[model samples]
Target chain A: MKTKNGMILSRYYTIADFEKEEAFLREQQRKGFQLKKFVLPCFYVFEACDPEDMVYRLDFAEVKKENKDSYIQIFTDCGWEYLFDVNGWSYFRKLADEADEDNEIFSDMESKIDLLGRVTKRRLVPLAFIFLCCILPQLVLQFTGMSSEHSETATFSTFFFWFFAAMFLVYSALFIEMGVGLNRLKRKYSKG
Target chain B: MEEKLKRVYVPMTETGFYILFCLQEEMHGYNIVQRVKDMTDGEIVISPGTMYGTLSKMEKDGLISFIREEEKRKIYQSTPLGTEILQLEVKRIERLYRNSKGETAVGK
Candidate 1:
């Protein structure tokens, strides 16, 4: 047995990148570093093990605290080892050898699309709402004639406005990217 | 409601069919999976993601209802609508099976 001691930090913006995340973890496992735990947002701790192919899957479930066990038990009983949950996303991994033919957490295309739809509704809809309703309007107002009348107030407001505008652009780009990725997934499954 | 359900769920997916069948006796998620696997002789295995996703959708569609909670496990059983739909699916499957067999064994 290889000595188990390794830690890696990674950042994934949205649940739509779940496939990429799973691939990354699978690659790491191939190199004998199995993910032991995941810290919220962007930290993954791994342990060394015999090199083996593993399948990692992510499910975005905002399970109630009371229902957490039963939610996890189903996966555990089905030979999927529950790794961790972060930000309403649950990570599960199983040895490749043990998995059934499909090896997917979702068996049917309709259910897979539905799961992605849930993630989109839970995570993307709110972001899209904020961008369309709040940030975009504020940015438009700031760019137009909404500057403060007083020079001091105007200078401060202008600085803050530009700062927020930049942040909003970054956030908006992320939201759009996530939306496109999710739409692609939906289309892929819907087509299948 | 029955007509609408038949239209929506007539040709049920294999996973959905087995799940509703398993829920006839008020089983939890894990138990439902086990029962399906046993009943199908390992031919059908509903993963956790698929199971819960189907359960949530079925519940939202009024096809199933939560029976009670037992130590953090939520017991669910098919509602009347679910049972009706399951029966419809069974009959549909039976018709398909019978037709296919009849077509294959015309001479025999």
Candidate 2:
């Protein structure tokens, strides 16, 4: 399709042309009519970004079919754009690569995952030490009959609470680390 | 070299396949987007950010190469390797269609 500016627009071209046409349409200051183009197998739908905002795209749709009626109907049903059969593979690859790049950019995700793993490991050491230092010694004293006839009772709930608390602390840390790792990997491989 | 072609699969991602698919018609980025939208009934969408990124990656991977930049938009075409991948994907999809038919129950 040819535009008023003498540019022969087609199914495939550069983004600059798309942006330029958008700008020209906006500069004319016409209200309601939108300047849309076929970027590939899709529609580069431009809408007013804001009242005073530069004319920009709100979203685009994959034009899998040549028919505008089908395209418009799908767009009306779901805000997401439809991809044409022709551009399906290319668009998928592009989406996947973008996800991969974004994953690489998340530097902090790696460290956060590592930090959580380390703390979880450390929590185990202190819990073990508590068992050896307090519980084990007390049990030994009771077994050896070192306690006086007037014995003080230790509740099972207290022991259960401490044991479970330590376990939960470690589990929580490990869980956080696992979550971070999965998220990072998802980002790294997040191809659409 | 033909055997090596088997190593590359048309990526499952829509953009990669769409880009390669459009190149079959010998088009550039903008045209590819239009063709894809037109073909897909507007179900699929590609943004400039995605278009540029995919084009660069495909060129790097030797799946597609730059033809030329006319009026600031770069053109791309499929390589021999890319063509092989597309053919393979076509075959795979065909098999998938056949297998799916077998799994579906016949109407009463």
Candidate 3:
């Protein structure tokens, strides 16, 4: 969507759906909206640019602040334009002609696997911890309370029970989706 | 060599090996990437992400030490331990090379 200015602000990406996110940026660039930067929780801002087919790639690395310059320098030297990073997800793009045949930010299978590992450890692991420790317990407790004390605060308990249950389902779905996606990527990259 | 360091660096990936090897002389991540691409005749171009990640890992593992900053690029060189680890890895690669050529060990 475009604001009064000629800039486009999109909010249709998720941490788990990075493949789609990269594609989304490429599509936008094709539509003449070049990505300028991003805000957290899925807002990718772009400015007007000449329509060109470029390849966008995302790399998940927990780099230190002091090392960020050198981190970007490496990519800049290798012909990738580092747009920006949000939450350890660095956004980069290169001309389609410049990218290698594989068109990947990682050259080796080991580094590809390493990127997946970082995503899992940084994203999925913490979500799993929240699902197991916090969400699940609250969900069970709310359900029990709703069933047992259906007298005074039945409506209140029922609301919370459903709320926690919905949260449980959402978290479960996210976890499974990302787990499967990452595993599929790992398996795909591991083969040759 | 320490067991932990050996396990980490001995079976180093090509990215890791080249990064650590090139750090024998102080160079930043981009320089190493260019050097590796040129060395391999562009057969093995180390992507910038891999180069940065490997350099950070080696720096943290004490295999490479940061020397100074030049134009916002941090220069690095192999520590004594890093050079030692590189030597071990080179020897291992030499053995693999010889075996690929079907050469038997000459003397113990």
Residue lDDT tens for model 1, A1-192: 233377565666566888998889999999988888876767777887899999999998667787788888778777898877787889898888554554788877888887887788888888878888988787777665435677776676687679769979898689788878988988888887
RMSD of each: 4.1, 19.7, 2.3
Docking class of 3: medium
Q: Is the docking of candidate 2 incorrect, acceptable, medium or high quality?
A: incorrect
Task: Give lDDT per model, in order.
Answer: 0.82, 0.48, 0.83
Interface RMSD of 2: 12.6
lDDT of 2 by residue, A74-190 (tens): 222322233333222211111113332321211233222332333334543565576567665555554444334533433444454466556556655554654555455445434
In model 1, what are the clashing residue pairs, if there are any? none
**Residue A84 lDDT in model 1?**
77
Q: Indicate whether candidate 1 or candidate 2 has the larger DockQ.
A: 1
DockQ-based ranking, best first? 3, 1, 2
Question: Which residue runs does candidate 3 get wrong by more than 4 Å?
Answer: A2-11, A98-103, B106-108
Predictions' DockQ, in order? 0.62, 0.03, 0.70
Reference-based lDDT, residue A26, model 1: 93
lDDT of 3 by residue, A1-192 (tens): 776544756566556678888888898889888888776666767888889988899999898788788788878877889887777788899877754543677888888888889989998889889889998898888777886655766777788899998998898778788888888888888994
